[model samples]
Target: MHLPSRPDLTKSVFGPQSDFIAVVFSPVLAEWDEGAFCMPLLDLLVARGYQVHVYDSLSLAQESSTLHATSENWDAYLRANYPQIDLAVGQAYGGALVNSLLSGFLKTCPRVLGLSAPTRCSAELQSNLASILTCLDMQGETAALDLLEYYVKPERNDKYQPLPPTKVEESGIGQRLRIGFSQLMKADARSHVNNYAGHMLQIYGAASRLVNTDSIVVSSDNRRQISSGISGCGMRPVIEAPEIALRLISDFLD
Candidate 1:
């Protein structure tokens, strides 16, 4: 895979050559690097002829006082850098960021896609995540990984194979995770969804422990409320069913 350079707010430019321009946001604890977990999705989009721009929410969060502020900053960044967006795709915490900014995007982007996205956060979920982070800080990566496995409840499938163990000791990873969780806790995407007048396809893991599948689904009122569209699908986690997830994304993009 050909990896793009890290996003520079002042120096980076979205190329003018591709037919489609996609801005993808990475989940918490993940960066837009060669080893990024979302590389497969990026590679697939590139192969499909998109000029893809990737951003890491953790980095974005570091620069802002609040997640909403971060979303606004990103909105400005997109408007300043890209002529227009063909599609927007985000996963996990990235999905939440996309949701938070969906209203502003509706004017320039026609379609949006969210994978394992959550629309609302409950106190229980917040508490659980806090516990996970505490484990990361006190007991280290091993404990955190164990707790993460418990939360994700990953399953093996033909299309979704287990990934090799990753080292979680990277600098600032823990801080990013904390910031991501805090942002998620404060995120409320209902207003954005209600205001967006464009096509949206929200996909979630039927078995996902992190996000409540019901909260993210587009309600009938939302379907009628949106100007362009609202739709959704549920499947196994991407890591447990990559082919299914990829196919869903391809179909939506096509």
Candidate 2:
């Protein structure tokens, strides 16, 4: 087996230095630095005295690793860096990624919040995702953004906007995008969620076409896991319905 190398997670630490730590992962479409996508929730947490560590890394970072290996790297990174983690939050791909990591790592499960998170990648979803992969492969980010637009159009929530297409000529990211999708195609977080012993809140948009919320199962054995649906939103529910999303997270944090 080709053991993938650890990612140089040159992350950004925001908010005041505090005992409480909130580790955040970014959605697939947005880079980790563009925290606005997961804003309000992130901002609210900081205001409530949590030191937020924003991971500003590549989408998948490791091109050859299996989903498990990728998550293992994240787990190891956290273990080496933090004495303890109080909370975990991620959106979409990030959500799923963190879910997989939390499912297995950490002796004691921390409180986790996932938005538009999927524990499994169904055959139908795999098929739909292939087209986006092809678009990224052939036309690059501009054309890929067009397809993402289709993803969020139905929600009629305009608040969440993916970064405008980039004109920079970096070839490495293109390769990573292809590799990332390949891994994402086969990524399954169900096993992770099933094993996770932490208190979790999995939230998805009712109108999300990207993921079938019914498929995101938090194993019945984990009584602490809560799965919720937000109306009038799509994959990007945090930005689309900031008020409701913040309230839900605030309540959970409290």
Candidate 3:
């Protein structure tokens, strides 16, 4: 499939702003549903005097024709365009993507804010993440299907709660369908845990250790795997994700 030209986000939504923040949303995992996960953050950022750029990972993946884009492509996009993004933020799958982008694309930005970023994304450093991806992708097709049934379908009709009622009004037929399936087939949480866990753990661990202002970590009420002692290494408790997400980005952008 031919990828659409990069949407004219800056001109169409942000007006003409030299310095702005990019608010990339996470791949809506199947069980969690859509609109429920991302819209709250958009509201918070808009209230902050920041021009937020929202990228649906699902839409980009379909157009890009890849379940996921590696950090290299993300970096190249930044270097080639939108390099002026002063700060980048996201959560869960989205968090992983932004971290990957910054790992490759960061130039002068002072901070990157991440919510519920799995330590496994830096697995090479965090030995605990060794099995992360395998656990997720072992049953790839089924997992994908589960995602579709839960989030994508509901998004189509605005049947899911926790989303603002206004959501039904804003999302058109096409976008709802596009968002639903994109979330389903693009990538699995486990696979993401595998590919980037080690790298992410090391990166965030280093940032924490170094007290780097360029990176910060926050998580929804989702508790880490206490048994394994990998605090912050599992699915974010779905309920708290939206609020925690908003706070992290707001502070980072401000």
Which predicted model would earn the best lDDT? Answer: 2
lDDT by residue for model 3 (65-125), tens = 3324544445555566664665455554565556445435553444554444432233221
Q: Candidate 2 on 1-254: residue-level lDDT in tens?
A: 22244355456777988989888877655233557667677779999999998774353356676667777767766666677888888776677677778655553647988887777776755776787776676667666657666775444545544444554353554555565556667768777777778788888888887765754778799788888888877787778888888888888888
Model 3 residue runs over 4 Å out of place are 1-19, 28-36, 58-69, 122-254
Off by over 4 Å in 1: 1-16, 30-32, 155-170, 222-236
Ranking by lDDT: 2, 1, 3
Predicted structure with the largest TM-score when compared to the true one: 2
Per-model CA lDDT versus the true structure: 0.64, 0.71, 0.39
Cα lDDT for residue 218, candidate 2: 82
State each candidate's clash count: 0, 0, 16
| Residue-wise C-alpha lDDT for candidate 1, range 1-254, written one tens digit per residue | 11123355312124445878887777775234532556667777777888777666655466326778778767777666667888887777888888888767444478788777766665655676787777777766656656755665532342423233454554555666667876777777877776677777776655455665444745455453221111222222455566777777777777
TM-score of 1: 0.76
Pairwise TM-score winner, candidates 2 and 3: 2
Residue range with the least summed lDDT across 10 consecutive positions in model 3: 224-233
Model 2, residue pairs in steric clash:
none
TM-score per model over all chains = 0.76, 0.84, 0.46
- Stretches off by above 4 angstroms in model 2 are 1-8, 30-32, 57-60, 155-173
